[model samples]
Target: MADLKVGSGEDIIITSGLGSCVGVTLYNKSTKIGGMAHVMLPEFPANREQGNPAKYADTALDMLLDKLRKKRVNLNRLEAKMAGGAQMFNFSSSNDKMRIGARNIEAVERILQEKGIPILGAEVGENYGRTMELHNATGKVLIKTVKHDDIVL
Candidate 1:
């Protein structure tokens, strides 16, 4: 997770070449604090974070929120935006893991709802890759996809 804490000033964080990967940003407007994570899996083995929390959605979010809390950011004021959960490739494989992209998005959304953090915006789930940028100054997410026009959320 990448974080710009209180008094850190305006900073933009980005993750490029996302495929079957989700980039989630959490921000507190009042504190001007924000964090982003490049999530590869919806959940970890047994859903445990172990060492690298950023490797999974659930653990990554936990780590991010803890960081924000340490910076004195109000959890109640937190808003979330996400992007880049593309299918990435085509295969006839029936394995559920092959659908990791969609599952990653689902896990993220579920976690947000459970934490009472509203999803302000999202650009997810397609057959193409995406790159996402989080603007800490405005809490706006910029998404660029190969097959679709760029979008801001």
Candidate 2:
């Protein structure tokens, strides 16, 4: 479920089957340049040195930013949108670590804040899975859920 992509005008980036995973998008309206990442974990494991950067919120964002920079995107003009991050299954213990969805959301928000990127919209922290679509041309995100109506963020 870990994946990331960057694109320009008219490019629609889509990720499906988001349960505890989160979908994050960064966009620059003026340039019509943006990126999306389907983040599977909150952070990278300290013991690991190498893996798919897209698998963690922290590394995925970093990779996305780097790609955007390579594309000459203005980081100062970036805005963010997010969806998914659902608490897919019920947990018996009240352990925060099991709350992967919430953790993923928090990690992304914190990183965006540290980078001074404002979040323009979000649809997170529910109990159902979601599918997200990023319309790079319009800088709009469409959130689709099986139990709810579609949301445009």
Candidate 3:
């Protein structure tokens, strides 16, 4: 659901209920600072100017990076880990608009690439919901799902 957070040191940022939504973490291991975003859509709506930026993958990472920049986290030292983007609903037609999870994943990856942030690991695209946590102190991302063993990325 449209939420984002930034933390430092031993803080752990967590997000749950990630069905068809993406959870992304940007971490600077040297500084022990990181940010997490629960992105609900692929891109921000072009017609709207007054919406939560955290709701869209295209805008969420920028917001997160700005916050991290304010905290003096070096962009050059940052790495990424991501989880979620589950296809919770089944669509009979092969319409792209129905593939929200896939679109979110693509948007996030593209944005990160444009920013020159390398993704260290990811757990994405399945039929189940997920929860993700970013451990700021360790730059470790933990992905939790109901049907599978907990994953560390």
Writing each residue's lDDT as its tens digit, candidate 2 over 114-134 gives 999999999999899999999
> Which structure is stronger by lDDT: 1 or 3?
3
Residues 1-153 of candidate 3 have per-residue lDDT tens digits of 798999998899999999889999999988899999999999999999798988999889989999999999999889998888889988899999999999999999999999999999999998999999998888889999898999999
Q: RMSD of candidate 3 to the true fold?
A: 0.7
- Displacement of residue 87 (Cα, Å) in model 2 is 0.6
| Candidate 1 lDDT over residue span 32-93, tens digit each | 78888888888768745465667888878998888888888899999999887889788899
Ranking by lDDT: 2, 3, 1
Report RMSD (Å) for each prediction in the order shown. Answer: 2.6, 0.7, 0.7
**Which stretch of 10 consecutive residues in model 3 shows the poorest summed lDDT?**
82-91
Give the Cα lDDT of each candidate: 0.82, 0.94, 0.92
Q: List pairs with backbone clashes in candidate 1.
A: none
Candidate 3 C-alpha error for residue 70, in Å: 0.2
